[model samples]
Target: MSAAAVPEWLAAEVAALSGAARAGRLPHALLIHEAPGAGGDWLAHFAAQLALCERAAEAPCGSCTACRRVLAWQHPDLTRVAPLEDSRQIRIEQLRDLAAELALTSHAGGYKVGILTPATR
Candidate 1:
């Protein structure tokens, strides 16, 4: 996708996050919080893509293989953990599983992103 996919209001945040990734200063994990409809999901997706982008200089470039996989939820380096409706809460098992996965090597040998959503559900 083009830069148009990211809203103008989140431009600064994305830029800063992208800069961090580019500078190798990005943390292993990040927590994104926002009120409902505040685009937390979108921002997390964007940041995840940036963190995993091979060519971060042109992140979410819409052409790289890594970007494509992330956009399609097929990126091996990206792990999304959200509370299931049945559970309605992030169980200890979920965190433990994520930790185990993070211990392994990434498919792309790059950043491994674990996106935990509905953290309070």
Candidate 2:
């Protein structure tokens, strides 16, 4: 989604994240909390796009190949962690695997982003 498409309620948070990214001061990890349908997942993906965008200067341009890949959930550098099928909670093995993946070098030689959804689970 384009920056303009971000919900107005989330705009300030997005701007802060963007500024941090541009300044090279973004945290190594972030926690995004949301109510049921609050677009938390979208914001998380946007954060990943900001870090993985090919165009660093205009990151999350929301149109670059990297951004497109992210939007499609096809980016090599983006790893999504969620509960297994029929499971209500993420298994420890899944988190271990996530750790292993993050330990490896990024495929694009840029940032590697892992998003853990339903963190409360």
Candidate 3:
């Protein structure tokens, strides 16, 4: 989703995160928690895309390369870790793989972001 699509209720949060990032006050790590349909996923992606955006606008310009990649889930710098196919859980192996991936620099010359989905099981 584009930055414009971000819900109004989350504007403050988005602004805080993005503003901090632009001003070099943002932390290297972030954690997002929300109930179902609360737009946590959208917020995560927006923050990530904004971080990688080259233009550094107030919000992520959806037409930019980094924005497109993030919206389409094709960004090399953005890695996703989810539960295994058969297991209703995220395994240690998966975390290990994420750790290994995070050890390398981003291919896009931007910050490497890992979007992890914890297992409900």
Candidate 3's displacement at residue 80, Å, is 0.4
Let me know the TM-score candidate 1 reaches against the reference structure: 0.90
Ranking under lDDT, best-scoring first?
Answer: 2, 1, 3
Clashes of each: 0, 0, 0
State residue 116's C-alpha deviation in candidate 1, in Å: 0.4
Tens digit per residue, CA lDDT, model 1, 1-108: 577787888888887887887787986666777888898888888887887777767876777888788878899988888886797788899899999999899888
Candidate 2: tens digits of C-alpha lDDT, residues 14-118: 999999999998789998988978989888988999999999988888889999999888999999999989898988999999999999999999999999988
Superposed Cα RMSD, model 3: 1.9
Q: Candidates sorted by TM-score, descending order?
A: 2, 1, 3
How well does model 3 score by local distance difference test? 0.79
Please name the candidate that would achieve the greatest lDDT relative to the true structure: 2
Indicate the residue-level lDDT of 64 in model 3: 83
Which runs of model 3 end up more than 4 angstroms from their true locations?
A: 1-3, 119-121
Per-model CA lDDT versus the true structure: 0.82, 0.91, 0.79
Query: After aligning candidate 3 to the native by TM-score, how far in Å is the CA of 53 from where it should be?
Result: 1.3
lDDT of 3 by residue, 1-121 (tens): 4556769999899879878987877678777778867888888888777777767755577778888888788988888888878988788898899899988988977688888765244
User: Which pairs clash in the backbone of model 1?
Assistant: none
- TM-score of each model, paired residue for residue: 0.90, 0.96, 0.88
